[model samples]
Target: MRSWLLKSLYVLAALRYPRIRPDLRYFVRDNYFARLNQLRFWRADFLTKTPYKVVEFYGEFDQEIRYAMPFAYWHFLNGTLKQTVASKNTRPFYFFSPDHVEKYEKRVWEAGYGNYSIPNMTHAPTYDFSKWARVPFKSHYQNDVFVYDKPLLVIANKYNIEWDKPPINFLDIPALDRLISGLKSRYQIVYNRPLGGQIVHDNSEIMDLGEHAWLRTTHPEVLLMNDLFDQHAATVQNFNHLQLLVYANCNHFISMHGGTAALASCFGGTNILLSHPGGGFEHEFNEYNNLFPNLSGATILHAKSREEVFTLVEGRF
Candidate 1:
């Protein structure tokens, strides 16, 4: 329903802003600063021979639109600003923030980009993080409220079996059971909310959503992005980036659909899906690879045996 409403809003926006109507994905939800980032990355001439001022405004926002930054700094910052007499040959970057935007704001500013605050982030209008925000930061709003004393066993969510197609497996009971059986001895378990583009209906008669089924049946405690869990305060407090950082730093594990493989690959952690048979979907067939070079790594292993799955994670810990 929320997604539908957002889509409707976009349709309405098309009528209101004809220029953005066709490229709503690049415009609509973006704030002025984020919009600028997209412009800069796409146009290189935006910068002069001088160094560019690249202000990075980061916070515990709900989501981070990392891809848009490259272009924004180039075109908007360097192009327009650099053309000005006072601003010529140098770049200035501004980041509006509510939380940790300061850290990023400072880093980017000190490194050459200028930082400026717009309005107080706490007062920013609340909306869905996926559609517009550069990075989701709801969890960052209440950082002190949640704490993790012991090592966390982070289990990210996978919306479905096949993102491009309907799900073939309705219940990944074996995967869940084996995960529990395999790691029960080594770690105190807690399932984390799954992020990334994988979308699954909580109740899908079609595609029989296997990932949702596993969460509903076995690890009823598993966190759903849509639903807040007991650790909702904590999870929200930590935001999703902290989870990634934790996984990157601590003794964490990954058992996800192939969508998460790139992060797992970069972090050097145990990604359970890597052991799947035939390495999941081969990306050579994926059409979007040209626009999104990252999708080329969509291939993952579909587990052939429970033992193979168990062995994959067992060695990682």
Candidate 2:
């Protein structure tokens, strides 16, 4: 967008949503322009001129789930999605009916709205899903082999580089200990921190938290995702598929920020996300209360601090 036009849009956004922070107001501007841009395709979609509309994206996993995936799902529901494209290991995510996702690209997601071409996709996910259909991940992936004695609680943690810096919005050993110690008896706890190369890398470098050995020694009862992967290696297609199976059966999750939380929120449950670095847009736009829930009616509780994680775990979880 031109600088002057961008300024004018920002002004319009501020006038529209005067109470929100400046960041979100600009997001509103971006979304409005993005919607305007989508008008170009109306003729094709309305006329059914194309046999199918192919939507392709290889962006950051978080943004993909937050914006792109849902946008594509809307097209699929409306009988227009012919094929979807993304980076490797995302077949499980797009495994809705007539699932056709070709994962052959490598594109690091920019912080900017690089996926504006996706119909209904914006920097911040919209609250309404009237045009969206929740992907039935649980129905497709749920299995009796993954059943547990008690209700499942998936603890999806990640220690990855954030914003060219060291790990942020991750659960350290102490926080893990507290979560396990507190919720051990009530639910079947599953600990997950996908090692480097296990999934697609999107600019963020996966750093070792060195908590796996500690979890084994300190809390042997908790099921480690790595261990589960090995145990069910013969049965599951890949790590992402394993997650879909396990998380499909789970109703409670304690996930770190970004993609980890995004995946967990796909299932209808309560996900307590640990985002220590100010909660980002998830807080700024109240996505936790609105957009996140739109995924599968999951209650996304954003904990801006580790202390608040415990508080939310005790009270909400």
Against the unseen true structure, what C-alpha lDDT does each candidate score? Answer: 0.35, 0.78
**Which residue pairs collide, candidate 2?**
none
lDDT of 1 by residue, 132-242 (tens): 222212222224433355444555534444434554322255667667656645565555444332221222222333455566676664434334333354633323334
Clashes of each: 32, 0
Candidate 2: 10-residue stretch with minimal lDDT: 122-131
The most accurate candidate by TM-score is: 2
Q: Could you tell me the lDDT of residue 6 within candidate 1?
A: 51
Top lDDT hit: 2
RMSDs, each prediction? Answer: 14.9, 2.5
Native-referenced Cα lDDT, model 1: 0.35
Tens digits of per-residue lDDT for model 2 on 67-152? 77787787777777778877777888887526566565565766336345754455454543544677778777888987888888
- The Cα error of candidate 1 at residue 91, in Å, is 23
- Give the least accurate 10-residue stretch of model 1, judged by summed lDDT: 84-93
